[model samples]
Structure formats: structure tokens, C-alpha cells
Target chain A: MADPIDFWFDFSSPYGYMMAERIDTLAAKHGREVKWRPFLLGAVFKHTGGQPLPSQPMKGPYSKHDLARSARFLGLPFTMPEAFPVSTHQACRVFYWLESRNPRLAHEFAIGVFHAYFVDGRDISQMDVLEGVAGKLDIAPEAVAGATADDAVKAHLREVCEVAIASGVFGSPFVVIDGEPFWGVDRLPQIERWLEQGGF
Target chain B: MADPIDFWFDFSSPYGYMMAERIDTLAAKHGREVKWRPFLLGAVFKHTGGQPLPSQPMKGPYSKHDLARSARFLGLPFTMPEAFPVSTHQACRVFYWLESRNPRLAHEFAIGVFHAYFVDGRDISQMDVLEGVAGKLDIAPEAVAGATADDAVKAHLREVCEVAIASGVFGSPFVVIDGEPFWGVDRLPQIERWLEQGGF
Candidate 1:
């Protein structure tokens, strides 16, 4: 019908995690193809004249309450993984690998990272945690880790991060289809329906 | 057992309309009393370093897409009202009157305004349109026009707008309970759960 849908995501976001869990099913229901693109969330924010959401001092109780209620309503758990605001380089690299090998696995990897944080309350920014999530997904844990230093993959992740910025991607868990961008996990179904309409 | 909740809101929001549609029911489910507070959303945004969600520019497509999905999910007929933005002074005063007089009707009036704009595509920013909305509610067509300029009510409206700024309320459809603020309509349930748990 139209071009495929691109989902730009990062490992350090709870809303991204929540959207990853449901987007695939919704996409399939609408007979649309989804491409998962993982990038560094922090860098994108820095480039886009925005700051890390948690960086806002006035937004503590308000953010927590909004997210907690959202989690309950969406039937997802809520927790700020101890390693939140953690480094996302390795995760983004692994995501790049998954995108090349199997996009479905990339989706699973994103979900694993989300569960590792909000559900298990683990330090996902840690190397061991990333390895564990990769292992569970049957990806070559060592190979994924080894590839982190590869100039090619590193450069690839770098390009995607830049591309995410240029695309007007203000936040993570972003969906772009037909030149339209939808942000927030709550907007997942809307993307799917738009995909279903195929440019109506 | 904590203090009763102070519910902050501006009438010119669809999400607030959605929240008002069910907030009281949710409150009753939790046996919590809501102290309805009327505030100016324009002022809240001005003081909070925030912009109307659509004004963010980056949030354009996301806003349209998300609202479409939310409408479908909620099974409510919604349209992006032609009048993108409107001031909430008159609406807020009527709300203040209803807040002090008949809360149930106040809620109806709020929902009516939101529905008029979001569902029927009416320009609520226009006084005549507001008059129509008020007349439809049997609120005395003049009440709508009269409240905006009434010295006492306008002053009260100003007081609440100032309070909203002081509280760091930067968004419309803002929900605050017991001095704790929840921004966005999505957080309504958490307020309910908090109240249910003997919370403020």
C-alpha cells in the first residue's frame, strides 16, 4: 500500500518499552510492515533543544504519578530501573545488529530491555545486564558485545541517532509513517490505524 | 487518611473533558471528595516554560495521531476542532460557579464545552458559541457572556490562574489532588487509586 512504518526507540525508556510490547500485534492487525530503529535517547534529546525528562526538577511527583497511572491503565508495570539515565550505547549497537539479522528479534530485544528495567528493576545500563538480555533472546551474547567496538556498527548507531534527530524525533518510542511522526507509547494504536488506512 | 484532593482544571481542554466525564465516577469509586479549582491554562503554560502541546511544532503529528487513537479506544466520536485554541476565562468562571453551586452541573458544562469543540468542531473561543453552549445547558445565555467580565468572578479567575502558576501547573487538563498535581488526562486513574488507598 504505502511505505513501511519506522519505529525509532532507545533502551532507557519505559514508554518505549510499553509501546514495543503492543506495536507488533497492532501493526500486524493492520497489515503493515514495521522497522525497528534503535538509537541513543540521550543524544537525541541533547540535539533537539530538549533535556532528559527526568532532568526537570519541577516534574518529579507529577511525572511519577502520570507514569504510574499509565502503567496501571495499560496493564504494564512501573519502576525506574536503578540504572535509569544509564548509558545506551551498547544497547543501541545490539539493536542495530538485530535490525540487520532479524527485525522481530530486535523488537524482542527492546521488550527485554524494558522488562529488565520497569518490571525487574535491574540496572540495564550495566554490561552484564545487557548480556543477560541478549542471552535470553538467543543472540550470541559475546558476539553482540564484541561488535560494540566495531567501527562500522558504532558508526551505524551514530548515524541512526543523527537520523532520529533530523527526523524531528523529539522523544523516544517514536513512530514515523507517511512522513507523520507520533510520540509517546500511548500513540501506538494511532500509528497502527493510520498504517491501516494506508495514507487516507 | 489524608487531606481531600484539590482538583485543578481549565475548561478548554478535550482531555479535561474526557477526565471530567469520568472523574467524579472514579472519585466515588474511591470515596474521595474533589475540591474543584479553576485555573487559566494560558497562564500555567506561560510560567512553566511549556507550550500548547500542538504549539511545540514537534508535537504536531503526534497530537493528531494520538487523539485519533484515543478517540477510537475510548469509543468516543472526536475530531480535531477547527478552532485549535481558545481562552478559558468565561468557561472557567462558569465552572467556578458550578464548582461552588452545583458541581455535577459544572462537570456537565465542562464536558459540554469540550464536546462542542472536539466532537462538533465548534469554535469555543467565540463568545456567541459559548453563549450557545451555556444556553443549551439552561445556564442563562447571558451567564456565559456575563461571567467573563463580572468583577468578582474575573478576579477569582485571576486568583486561580496565579495559584496555578505558583503550583507549577504548566498543562491543561491538569489534575491535582491534595496539592499534588497530575498533568494530562491519562493520570486520572492514579488519582482514583490514591484516593482509594486512603490517599489525598
Candidate 2:
């Protein structure tokens, strides 16, 4: 089997959430495994002078509209959270925590977090919210709390984010296949083409 | 016949150059005409707080790579000019001048300008270059020079740009079909889908 494609995204990104929904199935069809890695886009933005799409002047409103439009276009459920572009640091930590123990469970946990924000339009910022999501995933709220505070898990997430930065990941829905980088969910067609043509 | 699709782009935008090659055929396929409106992105950016893609910190480098990759992926000729992101004010003025008289001639003129900057890597900022491009189309160099200097032509472009901004065109290759706006070349699939399904 070919190596898994590195699919990196921040939990707060709408496009990231959309890509998360489709990437696994798309990769499976191409005989490629996807390593779902959630990282903090906030940290990455610090060095890159990047701001959330909605915070930027004109790009903000257009991006918000595009997000909802793109979701509908893709036939996916989408509802903007009341508080958008929230901090995903804690969510990232929990993802790494769950991922360290069980990759499959982590994937489900990530989906739960995505659903909590994107589908239900619920805020996933507070610990209780994350705990509720983890609880739904069969992960005990106490376990999620305990794992979130673990020094090793925190350090592991920081390390992964650092690596993602060094690897030129500046945006959500960033995909790297065999050292080739593709940013944005729109690159899915190009990704499919790359897999089909074995590099164009 | 339905209203023509509003295809707005700046000559300096790489993605805009790519879209110029495909939008016509795409629109024609659906029995729709395209209103190729070239506006000054820099002027629009002033109101929108948008900088060129290569000016943004991290996104700059990635955009440069993707521009070339996108051209190759689309099987189109692409050569980055030595002086990129050059001022397209004069070129735009010429476009409006030619467009006012003959929209067809203006379309061909726009293609010549795009090819000169993107394929031939020529410095199009010079008046001589503009005259040369016009000469190839059998448009008199003197007439080209006279049209570019026309005060009405200059104001016409400014008016067009203001209209574009009012219509919520925040980026290059922005397409508005039946009152729906789609941004970026990546949204081509969605655009096609929208036209086919009459809105999803």
C-alpha cells in the first residue's frame, strides 16, 4: 500500500471540516490512506501574519458567503456557528490526546468536534463543550479532561504544529502527498488528477 | 437568452490570466455569453484591503508554486514574467478603449496582452509594448496610443471598477452568474454545477 497522505487542518476551519468529511472516502478510492492531523491554525498564523478569513477586511464577508455556498455546492450540511473562527488550540490538544491512544477513535472524535461546530453550529470553545463531544464519542469526559492536561500530550501537539509549520502548512485543509503540497479544499480535483496521472 | 455571466479579472492576476482562457468556452457551452470586464484589482484592493497574493507572507510562496502548477494542470502555457504584478492601468485603459468600440477586438486584444505577460514574459508596462501588441492585431499603433490617452477611456475603467466593488467582486477571476458570485479558479466545478443544475 502507498504511504498515507498527510491531511492537516485546524478544527475551527469550515473548509477544514468540509475536507475532513470527504478526504477519507476520496483517499480510500485512490488506494491512499489519509493521516488526519488537526493542528492549531492560530499558532501557524502568528508566524505567517495570517488572520482568519472572516476577520480580514473584504475577504471576510465574501469568505463567509463562499463557505456556506461551497458546502451547499458539495451537498454537505453547514451552519455557521454564532461565534466563528474561535480558538481550536484545546480541540487540537484533545485530538492529539485521543489520536495518541487510538488513531481510529481520534478520527471519530475529530468528526464529533467538527459536527459540534459546523453541523450543529455549537461553540466548541469551552472545556465542557469538548467534554460533551468526547462523551458522545464514547470517551469519558474525565478521560478527555485528564488527557488534555497531560504534559506529554500538550508537548506532542506543540511538536506536531512545529513540524507542520516547518513543512510549509500555513492554511487549513492543507494536503501533502509524497512531499507535494496542495492548499485549499478546491485542490481536491487536482489531488485526484495527481493520483490518477501519477503526477502531472 | 439569459443574462451574460459577469467575468471580472485584473490583467496582472495569474489566476485571472488562466480564467481568461477557459471562461468563454465554459459559458458558451451553456448557451451563455460572458461579459469580460477587466478592472484594476489594485484599486479594488484599496477599498477591500486586499494585497496581491505574492505580497502576503506565507501564502505568497505557496501561491507562486500553485500558479505554475495550476497552469500545467490545465495544460496551458505559463511563464512568469521577470517583473510580476506589474501595473495594468495602461493595459486596462487600452482594453476599455478597444472594448467601447469593438468588444470582439477588445477580447482579442485582452488575449494578446495576457499572452505577452504570462507566456512571452514581456514587460507590458511600457507604452511601446502596448502599441506593439495592438500592431499585431492590425490596430494602428497611433490609434492605440491615442485611445489609451483618451480621458473618457480612463474614466470608463474607473467606473467599471467601482461597479465591480459594489457588486461584491473581491478577487480576481470572480464570476457572477444569475446574481450568484463565485471566486477563484478552484470554484470552476461549482460554477459548472450551478449552471447545469440552475442552482444547487
Model 2 C-alpha lDDT versus the unseen true structure? 0.89
**Weakest ten-residue segment in model 1 chain B by summed lDDT:** B191-200
Q: Which stretches of candidate 1 lie over 4 Å from their true place?
A: A1-7, A21-34, A68-78, A98-112, A119-146, A162-169, A175-182, A187-200, B1-7, B22-36, B97-108, B137-146, B162-170, B176-183, B187-200
Report clash pairs, candidate 2.
Answer: none
Output per-candidate TM-scores for chain A, rounded to 2 decimals.
0.89, 0.97
Q: Model 1, range B1-200, lDDT digits (tens) per residue? A: 54555667666666766666666677666666666676777776666566666775556656676667666655678788766767767777777766667877876777777778888888877778777777777888766666777788778888988877777676666666666567766565556666666443
Q: Candidate 1's C-alpha lDDT?
A: 0.72
Residues B1-200, model 2: lDDT tens digits: 99999999998888999988999999889999999999999988899677888888878888988999999988899998888899998989998898888999999999999999999998888888888889899999888888878999988888998998888888999999999888898888998988898888
Question: How many angstroms is residue B19 displaced in model 1 relative to the true structure, after the best TM-score fit?
Answer: 3.0
Residues A73-154 of candidate 2: C-alpha lDDT, one tens digit per residue: 7789999999988988788888888887898988998999999999998888878999999988788888978887889988
Note the clash tally of each candidate.
Answer: 0, 0
Best by lDDT: 2
- Write down the TM-score of every candidate: 0.75, 0.97
